[model samples]
Target chain A: MIVVEALSKQFGRFQAVDEISFEVQRGEVLGFLGPNGAGKSTTMKMLTCYLPPTSGNAEVNGFSINSQPLQVQEQIGYLPESAPSYNEMQVEEFLTFIGEVRGFSGTELRRKVGRVLELTSLQDARKQIIDTLSKGFRQRTCLAQSLIHDPPVLILDEPTDGLDPNQKHEVRELIRRMSEERTILISTHILEEVEAVCSRALIISEGRLVGLGTPDELLSQSIYRNAVTLSVSGKSAEALLEDLNGLEQVYSVERLEDMPSGALTVRVFPKDRESISSELEQFLKKKKMVIEQFFVERGRLDEVFRNLTLGN
Target chain B: MKGLFPIFKRELLAYFRSPVAYVFIIIFLAANAGCTFMLGNFYDSNQASLEVSFLFHPWLYLFLIPAVGMRLWAEERRSGTGELLLTLPVRTSVSVFGKFLAGWAFIAVALILTFPMIITVHYLGFPDNGPIITGYLGSFLMAGAYLAITSFTSALTKNQVISFILSVNICLILVLLGWGVLSEILNTIFPVWLTDVISQFSFTTHFDAIRRGVVDLRDIVYFLSIIIFMLMTNVVVLESKKAS
Candidate 1:
């Protein structure tokens, strides 16, 4: 439902977003992962028709952001970074104003407002001034405004930023619940949010697109993928490390720190993307080594994100 | 155009929902009344017309109109609400016109609340309704022209104070350009034709012409053109923010 074609935005000599191209299909939640000032907000602004790209363009629901901005805006709902809103307005009044601006009026407007307030769980704070509400409620109010029109496409810039853990979880749950019907592109620095909510992840750094794939696919790029870690108590650390390295299936082995209880932990790297845990287990059993703990690493997103976005 | 009504309605209501509209109206009435009675000496002038009252409008609007208009775009830009507003399915012109009309309507409300001045003048003497009515039309149009300039200045920056100061200075120059003493001083320094042309560009000249009951098409066009020009420039300023 969204196609970004070599989109580039330049502010004077600094290139904010440079030749970035990606597409998001319906029923897909694409997590935009980037560090601070990685042009993530810039890209989302261009997609939402708030900022004009200097060289290239984007399309939402087949409407070009450059030539058909109004039509594109009509089809997309956007939540800007920091979740800005009018502080003087009440929660319900603010949502109602947004609903009116979105072309709903009369009973339909009230129903839409009510539905979004419920969706964001802001019904209790309906008549309360937004300025007096807590940060979580204010963020939810802004979220409610974005969802008032029920647009098919949502572009949220840091939807969970500045929220507490529980609020973040609730927002992720809301996004997940809505993901089945809408195309969502959320930019966030939190890797766990991407893992919990996104079907595909796109990583960018320094205005360049570096990694794009499913969470598992991106994690596979990490060095720790398919690696085995074991904690032994009876064997000497050096001997176990040497023995684990001698095996043909084992690529290398490193002795991890000794635990407080005097147990030694070691990580074994496999020669390929295959299970080495069983082989290591058999080798330890033959060596009369007491294995206390063993598990295979399924890879980590943070490690993958760091590897892709490092040195930027 | 499609987004005009909602935008206008929201902006208009926003004023009343806060202390801005009430405080502005109260201060405006007090200052206008003070100017007429204390400074212009309305009772002492022994005039049957509201000319004494109309004379202070140009000066009163220098600060009052900017107060009403400085937040038009500056607050939106500062609070990042412009991002939400512009992203709506509306043309830039719609927001520009809608916001301008809202501020103009708000100043209209403040102006209408000064009805006691009219009642006092009529009760005290048989005032000529022609100049009184034209005086009000001239004041309303002048307020719009001043507000358009404030809106334009407001869009130039996100600081409301800076917007207010810049527009006040601009309006001050426009007022001084056509004031009697200023024009006489300039006439001594420059040629007669040059002083005449300079004075013609001043808002005071056109507003004064309208207040005197002449209602010339040129004077009406002058106020309207300034409003249009400033609002058009306001749109350009906002649109350029996206490119930069």
Candidate 2:
């Protein structure tokens, strides 16, 4: 649904988005992860035809951003970073205006407006002025505006930036539910959101593409991937650390702080990130170790995010 | 062009949606009445012609028209709604022309509200209706000319105050160029041909001719050319923002 080739934008002497290239397919939710000022919003602006690129090009629904921007705009439903809407307009009025601009009229425009209001759960606030609404409601209003046209591609910049946890969960659920047929490109700094809703994650830092893969693929790049963590009470901490470190499959064992119940906790590292769980379980049984808790880590996204975004 | 109607509708409704429209209309009517009755001495002159009332329009529009136009683009930029508006499947020229028409239509509404002045003139004596009708046409076109300049200045910055001040200064220069005192000063320092050429660009020169009921094509074209030139420049300014 979207293709970008060497898309670059430069403002004076500062390069906001460097020759970045990527593509998004239908039914895929791509998470745009970047540190602040990493050009995520800039890229989305180019894709939505809001900002023209300095060099290279991008296409949405096969319409080029440079030569066919109006057609490209027709294919996109963009939620700008600020989620801007007219403050003086009522919620229903705003959506109706957007619907009309999107080429719907009469009963169809009203139906489109009503559908988006219900989709965004903005039914009760329909008649209220936007300036009087809360931030989450305002965000939802903007979201509803984007959805009014029912475009196949959605480009949302920080869609959940100011929402509370429950609102965030609802928006994520909304994105997840909508991902069955549409191509979504959402820019956010929240790692958990990518894991929860996005089918693929693209991480950029310093205006450069650093990593692109699925959440699991990116997590596997972390140092903690597939590592086993065990809490034992029968053996001394020092003895267990030495014994765990001596196994052929184990590369190292770092002793962690004791649990609240006074059981010693340690993280066991595999030699090659392969599963040493079965072999270690047999070894523990032979050693007569009393295990309090034992589990293999699925890897922490924050660790992977920090490692990828924070310069090596 | 398909996008023009929706944008124009939204912008015009946006004016009435806030207190700006009512306050602007009230202040405009009150000020026009105050100028015509108190300052221009409409009753004492005993002239059935609306010359006294029409005399103050250029001066009134100097500040009033800019007040109506300054928010056309500056508010959009400040509130970040320009991104939303431009990203719609609309051409940039369509949005620009539509927005300018909406502001022009708003000033038309304000102009139409001054109908009682005509009723007053009709009740008192036999006034030359030709000049009066032409005077209103000239005023409406002049308001559009001034509004186009304000729209250009508004696109230059996101600050409404700056946009208001810039357009006021530009409109002041155009107004002063044809004023008697300024042209007299220019006559002493420059050649008559040069002075004529400079004042020809002034709003007062063309508007004054139309106010006298001439309805000359040259005068109408002058006001329309200003509107078209300024609106085209406004479109360029907005498009440049995307590149720079």
Candidate 3:
């Protein structure tokens, strides 16, 4: 539903978004991962047509953001960073105003506003003035207005930035429910948010796309892939490590500290792209060595993200 | 036009949503009455017409209009609703004109509330209603012009105080161009025709024409042109901010 091509935004000597290109199809929720000053907000602003890109542009739902910005804006429901809203307005009134601007009125405007309020769980606070609402409520009110038009694409900047853990989970579930038909691009510094809600993620740093893939794909690229940790009894870790080193797929083996229960812990590193589980099991059976714990670990995404964005 | 309706409604409703509109109205009514009776000496002049009240409008609007217009754009920027308003599927003209109209309507409300003085004048004697009606018209037009200038200054910065001060300075200069002493000082160095043309741009000159019971087309057009010119500048300012 959205395509950005070689889009760059430079402010005098500083480049905020540098020649970054990406596409998001309907039903895809793309997580934008970056730290502070990483151009996440700037990229979303360019996409929303809030700021014109210094060069190049993006298209939303078949409309150029530069040439047909009004049309592009009609199709986008942007939740700017900090979720700015008119503080003097009541929540219900604000949503109605947005609905009216989106070309809905009378029964239609009422119905759309009602629907968004329900979706964002803002019905109870609808009567309260925006400035009087709590931060979580205010954020949800922002979310409500973005949905007031039922746009095909949503660009949310830190939707759950200051929410409590429960509120964050609720918003995540809401995004998940809405992810079936809408294309969503949400930027967040919270790594686990990508793991929880995004089908694919793009990690940007220093105004460049550093990593782009499914969470699992990026995780598998970590150095920890195919590494195994084992706890065994009836054998010293030295003996186990020595035997595991003799296996063909075993790249290396190291002994860990002894467990509190006296079981020796050892870690086995398999050769690249190799899985030695079955062979190691058979070898253990042949030796009659009892195993306490055996775990073949998946790579940690946090470790992968840190290496991708900050390593370079 | 349809797209601008909601923005206009929201902006107009914003004034009433807070105490700013009420406080402004009360203070405005008192100030207008004070300027007419205390400074213009309306009763002492024994003027059955609203000439004294109308005469002080330009001076009163100099400060009052800017106070109302300063927050029109600066508050939006400070509160971050600039993003919300600008991202709507409306053209820059729609937003700019909508907000300008809302503020102009507010100044209209303040002007309309001076009806008690009008009633007083009519009850005191058979006043020439023609002059009074055109006087209010000129005052309203001059207000629209001053408000347009204030709106432009407001768009230049996010600070309300700076917006107010800048607008007051600009409005003061525009007002002073037609002042007697200023013209006298300028006529010493410049040609008489040049001085006349320079003073013609002042709001006071056109306002004076209308206040004298003559609603000339050029005077009306002059006030409207100033409003249009400033709002066009407002559009450029808003657009250029987005470009960077």
Candidate 4:
């Protein structure tokens, strides 16, 4: 549905988006993950034809952004970051104006406006002036304007920002429903949103694509190694650490704490699960340490993001 | 054209929904009426035509039209709605033309409200209606030319105050070019032909020609050319901004 190639945007000496290339398929929800000022919004603007790229090109639905911008614009609904809107206009009037500009008229325009209000759950605030609405309602009004045309692709930049938890959940559900028919590319820092709605994720750091895959696939790459923690009551932490360090499968063992009752919190780093669990069982038996709590810490998307972005 | 119609309707509605259009019309009419009747001695001068009323419009529009036109694109840029409007399916020229026509229509409404002066003149004596009609036409066209220039200036900046100041300064130069004070100064330094060419471009000169009951093609073409030229420049400015 969308193809961006070598898309780099520079404002004089500063590069906002640097040579980033990616493709989004139809009906796929792709999450663009990045920190603030990471060129996520810049990339979306190029796709929406709001800002021309300094170099390279982007295509939406087979139309070049430079050569056939109107055609591409006709097919994409863009909700820019923070969703700036005309505050003086009522919600319904704003949606109607957007519909008219997008080529809907009369009954079709009314129907489209009605459908978007329902989809964004903004029917109650339809008559209220946008500036009078709360922040959540105003953001939904921005979404309604974008959806009024019912375009095939949605470029939502931080759609759920500033919303209460309940409103965020409601918006996520709406995005999920919209995703059944439309191709969506959402840029967000919320990792849980990616896990809940996006089918694929693209992690960018310093204007470079660091990782791209499903959540589980990215987790399994061991960008975060499997590390287990054992709270044992029968042995001293120093003894446990010494014994665990002698095992072949154990990469390292450190005593996190030494309890007054002679218990210990030992953090064990292992190469893999199969090798470490069996080796630790045998090694702990020899050391006579009774394991109280033993659990392996799995890799979280947040950890992977921080590790990749902060490291780069 | 289809896209332009809706934009035109929306812009016109937006004008009325706010106090800007109403205040603009009221001030324009009150000033035009007061200057023509009280200041210019309309009835006491024993004039049987709209010459006094129409003659003061160039000075009125020099300031009034900018109030109507300064917010045309400047507000869009300030509110961040320019991106939403420009990225839509409609062409840039359509939006530009639609906004220009909306401002022109409001000016026309204000011109129509000056009908009381027309009625009062006709009530007193038999005035030549030919010059009156042509004068109204010339005034409306001249107002359109000023509006087009203001609209172009509005697109250059996001601050409405800056747009208003810039437009008033430019319009003031255009209005004063043919006057004796400015022309006399120029006549001493330049050739007579050059001075005439410069003075002929003044909106006051063309408006004065039409006010005399003479519908010269050259005067009409001058007003039309200024309107078209400014509007085309408006379109080109917006298009080039979008390109970069």
Candidate 5:
């Protein structure tokens, strides 16, 4: 439901966001992965119409950001980074203000505010002043403000930062809950979050679009993809290594450890999308070698992300 | 216009919710009464008109108006709420005008509280209330003009102190342009027409014109033009900053 085309933003000599283009379909939760100053926020700002792109443009729900900003804004709920809020206001007051400004009135305004407070789990702290709230509650309040209008599109920048593990899980669950029917785009430096909730993700670095695909697609690009680990007991390490080396579809087997309990651990790399698990299991059964641990490894995107973003 | 009520109500409530409105009003009343009684010699002059009470308005607004207006946009920028406010469905002009009106209304409340001075004068002597009424009108309009200027300066930076000082300096210049001593010297150093033109733009001259009991439409227009001009510039400044 969001189309960002060749969007670029520059602050004088510094280019904050280079030409980046991508689309997010309805019911998709797109994770924006980037390091600090990677232009992720800038790109989101352009889409939200908070910042005019230095060049190029974006469109939300078929309305061009440059020509129809208000229309575009009306459809998007933005939770900005740091979740800046009016510190002097109470939680309910701030949510009500947001609802009122969006043109909700009377029972409709009350219901909208009520829905958001429930969605964000902010009911207990509704009457508390914002400045007095703890950080997690404050963040939830900001999230409630964005969700108060129930807009179709949500652009949340670092929605789960600085929270403890439980609070982070709560916020992530909240985003997941909201992502069922809405097109949601979230920018986060937290790597695992992409895999946890996002159906697809876009990675940007140094103000440019560096990677874009599903979490699995990105993981498959990792150097560790499809590799398998073989650990066994009641076997001679050298003989097992030799037989594993001769197997088809197996490019290389690197022995990692020889345990005191007669256990052997070896990491086997496949050759070109091959699977040698069945043959290896059959050979072990023929020799009557006990299997301790055997499993194919999925690619680790953390490795891929570090390699891709840090390499540049 | 549609977004006006939310912004106006929020800002007005903000004023009362903080100590800023109460402290400012108390100080404003004190200064107005102090200037009238101590400096203007209310009893000594036996003056039926409220010339002394209104006299402090131009000077009072220099510090007080800026104090009220400095937080208008500067606080929003400092706390990063400017992005949230600007990105709302409301137009920029609506925010600017609504906020300006809130500050104007606060000052209007303070001015209205100066009724004791009027009551005192009425009890003391036979006074022409026409000139006193126009004087209040002049004070209210001049306060609005000062607030508009302060609001514009406040929009320029996130620093409230800088906003306060910059607006105070600008308002001071506008005030001095028509003060008797400054304009007298201007008439000598520059061409007489230049002094007249500069004095025409001063807060003092227009306010004094209204105090003379003649509510000339030109003087009213001049103050209004200043308010409108400053407000439009405030909108332009905010809009330009959004790009930068």
Candidate 6:
């Protein structure tokens, strides 16, 4: 449903979005993960035809953004980073006006507005002024406006930025439901959100695509292989570190200290753990090291994100 | 045209939903009425005509029209709604012209409210209603032209004050071009034909022709050309933003 080729945008001497390309298929939820000022919003703006790209081209629903912007705009609904709205307009009035501008009329416009308000859970706030609503409600209202036209493509920038935890969950659920029908490109910094909702993730840094893969694929690329943390007490920290480092299957080991009497926390990176766990058990028994706690430390999505982004 | 009507209706509703249209109408009517009755000496002049009342409109619209036009685009920029508006399916010219027409229509409402003055003139004596009608037609067209220019200026910046000041400055230049002082300066430096060409561009010349009850086709075309020209510039300014 969407294609971007070598899309670059420059403002004076600064390049906001470098040459980046990606495609989103129909009924796919693609998460755009990046830190602040990483060209996420700029990319969304170019795709929405709000700002023309300085180089290359972007097409939505088979229409070039630069050549046939009005047609492209007609097919895509965009919620900018700020989720801007007119404060003086009531919820229903604002949505109706947007629907009318997008070519909905009479019973169709009314029905669409009603459907979107219910979809965004903004039905009760329909009569309230936008300025009087809470941040969460305002965000929902912004979402309602974008959905009123029933566009096939949705470009949502930080759709859950200001919502509470429960509201965030509701929005995430709503997005998951909506993804079944529309092509969604959602930009956010929340790593867990991608794991929970997105089928694919695209990580961008410094206006460049750093990583793109599924959640498990990204987690497997971490430096630490599958290993367990063994808290031993009888052996000194120095001795445990020395013995773990000398093991043939051990890649690396680090001792974490809490206090003189506390259990030793050791993170072991194993090269070949199939035979190493039995060997380590026998060695610890012979050395008479008291093992208090042992648990396998799985790589987390947050750790993967931190490592990937920080390493670059 | 079907696409244009929705934008026009939305813009008109927006104006009324806030205090913008009301405040503009109230201040416009008050100032226009006060100037006609007190400053122009409507009853005291007793010339058996609305000439004095109609004469004051050019000066009134000079500043009042900017108030209506300054927010045409600047508020959208300030509120971060420009992206939302620009990304809609409607063509740029359609939206720009629709918005300009809405502002002009609101100003026309305020102008029409001055009918009491017309009634007062009709009650006192026999006034030439032909010139009065054409004068209003000329004033409405001039206001549309000025509002279009102001709307174009508003799109250039996010600051409404700057938009107002720039529009007033540009309108001042156009209003003053055909005056004796400007003509005297131009007559000394340029040939008589060049001076005449320059004077013809001034709104004052065409407006004067309509105020004399002539309704020349050339004057109508001149006013319309200015309106269309300024609206086209407004579209260009907005489109340039998308490019850079």
Local distance difference test scores for all models: 0.91, 0.92, 0.90, 0.85, 0.89, 0.85
Model 5 clash pairs are: none
Better of 2 and 4 by lDDT: 2
Which residue pairs clash within candidate 6?
none
Stretches of model 5 off by over 4 angstroms after superposition: A236-248, A251-262, A273-276, A283-288
DockQ winner, 3 or 4: 3
TM-score of chain A of each: 0.96, 0.98, 0.93, 0.87, 0.94, 0.86
lDDT of 1 at B221: 92
Question: Per-candidate DockQ versus the true complex?
Answer: 0.80, 0.83, 0.72, 0.59, 0.69, 0.70
Model 2 chain A worst lDDT run, 10 consecutive residues: A232-241
Per-residue accuracy of model 6 over A151-270 as CA lDDT, tens digit each: 899999999989999999999999999898899999988888998788888888778788888776776666543666788887667877898899888888876664356868787787
Q: In candidate 2, how many Å is residue A215 off?
A: 0.5
Clashing pairs in 1: none
lDDT of 5 by residue, A144-173 (tens): 888888889999999997788998998889
Candidate 3, residue B244: how far the Cα is off, in Å: 1.4
| TM-score of chain A, model number 3 | 0.93
Interface RMSD, all candidates in order, equals: 1.0, 0.9, 1.1, 2.0, 0.9, 1.6
Candidate achieving higher TM-score, 4 or 5: 5
Identify the runs in model 2 with alpha carbons over 4 angstroms from their true place.
Answer: none
DockQ of the two-chain complex in candidate 2: 0.83
Considering lDDT, which of the candidate structures 4 and 5 is the better prediction for this target?
A: 5
- What docking class should model 6 receive? medium
After TM-score superposition, the amount by which residue A88's alpha carbon in candidate 1 deviates from its true location, in angstroms, is 0.6
Candidate 2 per-residue lDDT over residues B76-102, each given as its tens digit: 999999999999999899999999999
